[model samples]
Target: MPAERVCAVIPAAGRGTRLGLGIPKIMVEIADGVTVWHVLHERLRPLVEHIHVVMSPEGEGPFRALAAGRIESGAVSVSVQGRPTGMGGAIFGAAPHWDAHGTILVVWGDQAGLSPVTAGRVVEAHEKGLTIPLVPMPDPYVEYELDDDGTLLRVRQSREGDECRPGGLSDVGVFCLSTEGLHEAWTRYLDEAAPGARTGEVNFLPFLPYLSRERGWPLTVVPVTDPDEARGVNTADDLAFARRAHQRWAR
Candidate 1:
């Protein structure tokens, strides 16, 4: 088989109401005039030939203005999500732009402390299969259950009164998906998703178990060495914390 082409997909369409920021959370500046989106793109650029950014319709103009050079140079392409369809929709919106025979690296646009090396590690470890970057979590926000040999068994959501496991791995929103399996899973999700669901969105997590159990897709988990690299900016406090983490990682 020919070398597998890899593309990076960034979902930045969320309104981020909790942050109460006037702008999209991904546009929030983390460093001197450098926003989270810039950091994510800079990190993924070295690992993939093309980067597709999914932004809200209203955020397109600002994002384009911010990434003008990259867009003009064909290094980055932006797609507008007509409405909020959650992360799953954002990924699907950019689906047509992906290479049919290649693999995709789905990284959240608000991810901070992401370095080129870290992004490269995920791609290198994929080995032309499915891979999800995981980080040790003090509390199990969202946990991935794995087999003894490291094969992904299923994903478990945190419940009230649950204690954190000693070495729990949380999904860091970084996924390396094979084009074939992605299409299969995405199609199944759209077909089965109910209208006006609880969150009014299709979360990608719930499908992992279905894919592994029903579809028989081999899933691999790659642990992220620096937990900071998997950190995402949500609330004001999260932004502050991520900024500090980025500064430390940059040094």
Candidate 2:
């Protein structure tokens, strides 16, 4: 009931166990004044109608407190992921908030500074019928080298042109899906896969090649230049990086 055109689901349930912090990683303060998830949800709210935040059972308390303090431009809700099923499961937790026939957008809990303008272009791509927003990684790049625990290193996608070529779109954390799109995403990639499966987290990126091959579902990647648009906080370092980027944006 917030915004009619879209809904955004943020999976914030993962423990930042690697961050060595006892609190939920998503709740960690990345800036002088904001948490990573707050920046993410705030920026994402205007592009969609409603925002559903998925938190682990252990996380619901903090997340609720966090959401309660925000001036949500869109309708905001929270759901508890009852188990540690994986990324797919955290995402599936937000399904109840969606109607069976509308569009939904998704981002990770730790992500910040995604450009709403680019998000809008992604929506336009969907209006034209692309199942996924295939955003072209910027020409000059800031690549995030994420690790099992920390972001290992970041290089320009072009700089690593061999593994991730220039002009080759790397999978960023933002995804917009229809209600049917959300269901399809869950069914096509997650349902058959075992719950708690390691690859269950393959909720987004892995689907692209298959989509390109089979359904011809157009994956549109609107061009984005600032690598800040795709920053996701995993460790303290990433949080620091995103915080600095966000400060620059506020100015």
TM-scores of the models, in the order given: 0.88, 0.74
Q: What is the C-alpha RMSD of each candidate to the true structure, in Å?
A: 2.8, 7.3
What TM-score does prediction 1 earn?
Answer: 0.88
Best by lDDT: 1
Cα shift from native, residue 62, model 1 (Å): 0.4
Clashes of each: 0, 8
Q: lDDT per model, in order?
A: 0.76, 0.61
- List candidate 2 stretches off by more than 4 Å: 1-3, 69-74, 128-168, 181-185, 188-203
Predicted candidate 2 versus true structure: per-residue lDDT over 1-251, tens digit per residue:
23566777788888888788877777888676588776776677677767788888888887787778552544688888887666666766667776543676777777675666776666656752333333455442333333343222222333223255455444457766555554565577554432223333444444433444344444444556655565567667887787787777788
The true-versus-predicted C-alpha distance at residue 234 of model 1, in Å, is 0.5
Per-residue CA lDDT of candidate 1, range 23-93, in tens?
A: 88879988789788878877777778788899898899998999999999998889999988677778877
